[model samples]
Target chain A: MKIGIFFCLKVWNMNAKIAIQGIKGSFHHQVAQEYYYQNVEVDECLSFEELIDSLMSGKSDQAVMAIENSIAGPIIPNYALIDKNNLHIIGEHYLDIHQNFMALKGQKIEDILEVHSHPMALLQCMEFLKKYPNIKLVEDKDTAETARRIHQNQLKGIAAIASKTASEMYDLVILAPEIQTINNNMTRFVIINKADNFVSKNEINRASIKFELDHKRGSLAAVLNVMSDCKLNLTKIQSLPKIETPWKYSFFVDVTFEKYEDYAKAKALLTIMAEYFKVLGEYKNTKP
Target chain B: MKIGIFFCLKVWNMNAKIAIQGIKGSFHHQVAQEYYYQNVEVDECLSFEELIDSLMSGKSDQAVMAIENSIAGPIIPNYALIDKNNLHIIGEHYLDIHQNFMALKGQKIEDILEVHSHPMALLQCMEFLKKYPNIKLVEDKDTAETARRIHQNQLKGIAAIASKTASEMYDLVILAPEIQTINNNMTRFVIINKADNFVSKNEINRASIKFELDHKRGSLAAVLNVMSDCKLNLTKIQSLPKIETPWKYSFFVDVTFEKYEDYAKAKALLTIMAEYFKVLGEYKNTKP
Candidate 1:
C-alpha cells in the first residue's frame, strides 16, 4: 500500500489491484469485498492458475487464495500452487462459512428430494444429509451457484446448500436453515503479493517452510528430530506430490520457533537447518 | 478360515454387515468396493449419518468414511462425525479419484455452455472451467446422475465432471478425460468398528484424540505446550465447533504418541490434563 500510494501521489500510475478466482457471488468474491472497498478494481481470474499467473506476470498487484475451510482441512492443491508459483504469503484472514439449505420459493423442506452443495458443504453437513437419505448428495462448484440451479431448474423436489445471501439472490426459501453440521465453521484465506508484505515487527516466532529430501528411509524422521532438538513446536505438516521431481514428495511445515530464542536466533537455526533441507518461505503468524 | 469352516460345519450364522454412503457410481461406493466382498455384506446408506448410525447400533459390522482427498485436503465434517460417534478406527485405505469430463454423445467441448459436477470435482477442474467463463457451473448431487441428465435432456451445451465408470454407466462421451486439475489424486477412507481394536502386538506409536478446552485466552497455546513437553509429535490439529457447549472449542489431534509407552502412560497424561480439558477418546491411528 505504501508503494502504491507513492506511485499514486508522485506519478498517478498505480492502483492496488486484488486478484481473485470465480465470478460474482462466489466466496472468493465475498472475501475480496470484505477487504477491498466496493468498486475496487479486481482482476477476476477464472482459476487459481490464472490468478497465480497474473500475480507472477505483474498483471495483478496481489492475489487472495482460500487456504482452508472449516469443512476441509486445507485446499491441498492451492498450497502446492502457491509453493510451486513461488508466491509470498503476506497476510491471512478468516471468513465465517454459514451454509443454508435452499430451495425455490414456496417449496417446503419435505418437497425436496435431493440436496446440492459444494462437496465440502455436503461433507460438512454429512449428518444433516443423513436425515434425508432418499435425497441424494451432490457436489457443485460454488455454494451460491447451487442456489441458482434450484431456481433455474424450477424443480420443487430439489434444494441447495448455500449462503443466506444466495437464498435472497435467487428468491429461494431456506429449506433447512443453517444445515452445515458444525456451527462454528470458518475458512482461512491468505493474501499473497510478489513484493514483501511479510517481515512483521510483531513476528511471534511463526515460520512456513517447504522441503524435499532424497526419498529414503528415515529421511522425514531425521528432519523432524532436528526441530524437536530445538524444542520448536510443529503446528502443521501437509505433503504435496513432487511436481518437479516425479514420484517424489514435498512436505510443508508450519512451526513456531520458540519466542525465547529471539528472531535472530530463530533465523540462525532455520538458516543452518536449510543446509540439509529446502526452506520454502517464512512469514510472521498473523493470527490474532 | 479355520473358524469360518468350523462355524459352517456347526451351524449357519449371520455374516458381517458393512454400511456406506452413496449409490452405485459414486466415489464412496467405489471406495467401499475395496472392502465389500466375501464376509462383508455391504449395505448402502443414503447419507454419511446412516453409515455412522449403523456402526453405532451394531446394525453394521463396520462403516466406511472418506476422511480426505488428495486434490482436496481432509473431509472436515467426516472428522466431526467420527469424533461424535463412539467408533474405533480399525484400518485405513486410499482410493485414487479419477474425474472424467463427460457430455452427451456427439457433443463437442466448444459446445459446452454449462458444466455440472459434485462441488469438489468442480473445484478441482477450476483451472479448466476458467476458459469457459461464460459457461454456467451447475452444482448437482450425483456426478453420474448429472451425466444421466445430460443424456436424457440432450443438452448439447451441457457437460458433467464425472467418473469414467459413470460415463460408461450412462453411455456418454468423454469430452475431456482425467479432467481434474491434478493427477495422482486420491482419497483416504477409514473403517470404523464399534469395538476397541486395540491390540497387544504391532507398533502402537499412533493415537487419535479429541478434546474440549475452556474457551479462554491461550487455551490452544497451553495445550500445544503440554503436548510439546510430552515429546508427542503433533501431525494434524483441526477445530470442530462445540455446538453443544456455547463458546467452548473442541479439537481433533493426530499424533505420534511414542508407541513404546503403555496405554496408561498416554491416558495418564490426558487424565492429569483433564481439569482444563475434555478427553473425548483415544484410538489407534490408522494412517501409519
Candidate 2:
C-alpha cells in the first residue's frame, strides 16, 4: 500500500524539491539533508510562512518544518499555519539538536563579553551561560548567521552559540561544546505537502490528528473514552485556541496502536464526534 | 474565604512590588498596572528568568508573565519555569495587545525599508506587512526598546511594531494602528508567586494543575474520565517534557466546574491517580 501511494504521488511530479527555513548549516538544513538526499537542492526560506508558500506555489515538493522541540516545546503558530493553508503532514523526523559555543581563534571564555545566537539557542544554553557572569547574552536572527557574521567581521570579545557544523563552516573555534542545558535535546520535524498523502503501511503504529469538539461538558473526555475503547493509546495532546472563534480550542493529538483496525475504529468514531476532524499523517512511531 | 486568604497574604507584606519583563510602557507593565494597583511599584527585568528570580528573592510580591496569546499561542518555557521554580498561579489578567506600526515623524509605510519588533509581535502583524514587499522584518530583543531606539536615533526608513502606548511614550508617530492580523488580539497573563496562595473560595470555579501520569496504555484517558465524571470541563491542556527524564512527559491542565464540590472530588481523584500531582492554583474563571 505504501509503494502504491508513492507511485501515484510520483506520477504528478518528476523532481522532488525540499524547502527549509534557513541557509546551509542551519538545523532545518541539516534535517532536510538527512531526511532527503544530501545532493537534493533545498529552497531556503526566510520565515516559516515563506517555507509553506514555497510548497503551495509548487516550488518545492515537500517542506520540512520543526513542529516541536524537546526543550522549547511546540511551535504553536506553525500548527495554525498548517491548518489555515490546508497542508498535510506526510512524515515526521526527530533530529538531535546540539549547540556549541564558538568564538574567534585564541579567544577564551573570559575574553568574550557578548555572546549572540537565536533566542531559543540562548535560552537552551542558559545553564552553561550562568557560570559566566561577565558575558552578556544577545538574541540574533539566526544561530548560523550569527556565526557567519562573527567570522566575517573578525570581532573580538564576541561569541556565538550554534551548531558544531556552523562553527566549522565559519572557521570559528568551539569555545564550549554541547552548551545546551540538556544532553538529549531533540526537535520533531514534520514533512508536509499540499494534500492528504497517507500510506497504510503494516508498521504504521502512530497517527497525527487534529479535531474540534462541541463546547460542552465532557466533550473532550468523550473523545478520549472513544480512543480508549478502540484500544488506541494517546501519546501526546496539545490544545490551540481557534483564531476565528475567540476562546474555543482545537486539539492536536497523536495516538499509537498495535493493531490497525483499532485505530480505524477510533478514527471513525472521532470523525462523527468531532467538528473538524483531520488525520494529519499516519507514520511510524519514532519516539520512545 | 478568598478575603480571609487575602488578609493573611497582605499582612505579610505591606507594599506590593510587581515584577515585569520589560521597562515602563511595555505591555507587561500595562498589565501589571491594571492587575495590581496603578500606583504599584514595578520591578523591571531584562528577561523572564530575571522576573522569576525577582520573585524567588522576595524582591517583588508577585510577577506578571504572559502565558498565552490569542495569536502567538502559549509561551512554552514559561510553563516549565513555573513548574521548576515552584511558583503558583495566583491570578490571571487578559490584556488587549494592540501592535501599532510606528516611525519617525512624517514617514509613511512606503518609506519604511526595515521594520523591527519582538519576534512574537512581528508574527502577529504578518498579514498587514504582506502589503509592503520592500519592507524587511527584523526581530529585536524588546518591542518598546525598539521603539525607543528608533525614536532616539531619529532613524529614517525604519519603523517599529509595538504597543500604542510605546509609540506615545517614545514620541513616535503611529503609521498604522492595530496592524496585528486579528482585531481581537489579547494576551492572557498569569500572576505568579513563589508560595501556594490558593484560597479555595466559594466562587472558585477554575483551577490550574500539573501532574504526571503512569506511562501505561490508558492512564491519561482514565484521569480525564474521572474529571468528566466529576462534572469538570477541561479548558486547556499542555504537555511538557520532564527535565530529568528524557522520554517522560508531565501534563498541565486547566479545568472549570460549576460547583466547587465537583472540582474537589476531581482534584482528590487526580491526586490519588496521578504521580507527582500538584495544584498550581485555584482561582475564578475570568475569561468569557
Q: What TM-score would chain A of each candidate receive against the reference chain A?
A: 0.79, 0.90
Per-residue lDDT of B269 in model 2: 88
lDDT score of residue B140 within candidate 2 = 80
Model 1: per-residue Cα lDDT over A1-288, one tens digit each: 433432342344336677887555567767777755554567777557778988998987877888766455666778777766767776566787777888887888777787766666777776688777778776555677667777877868888888777788788888677777777677777778776544453443566667655544334455566566566666556555454222245567666664636434544555564433443445555443
Question: Residue B285's C-alpha lDDT in candidate 2?
Answer: 77
Candidate 2, superposed: residue stretches over 4 Å from native? A1-15, A198-200, B1-14, B198-200
lDDT for each residue of candidate 2 in B180-262, tens digit (9 for 90 to 100): 89988889999898776454567588889999998877788889889989988898997877775665788989998999989
Best by lDDT: 2
Off by over 4 Å in 1: A1-15, A21-27, A43-59, A69-73, A97-138, A145-183, A197-207, A211-261, A274-288, B1-15, B25-33, B36-41, B57-59, B69-71, B95-186, B197-288
lDDT of each: 0.65, 0.84
> Can you list the residue pairs that collide in candidate 2?
none
Best prediction by TM-score: 2
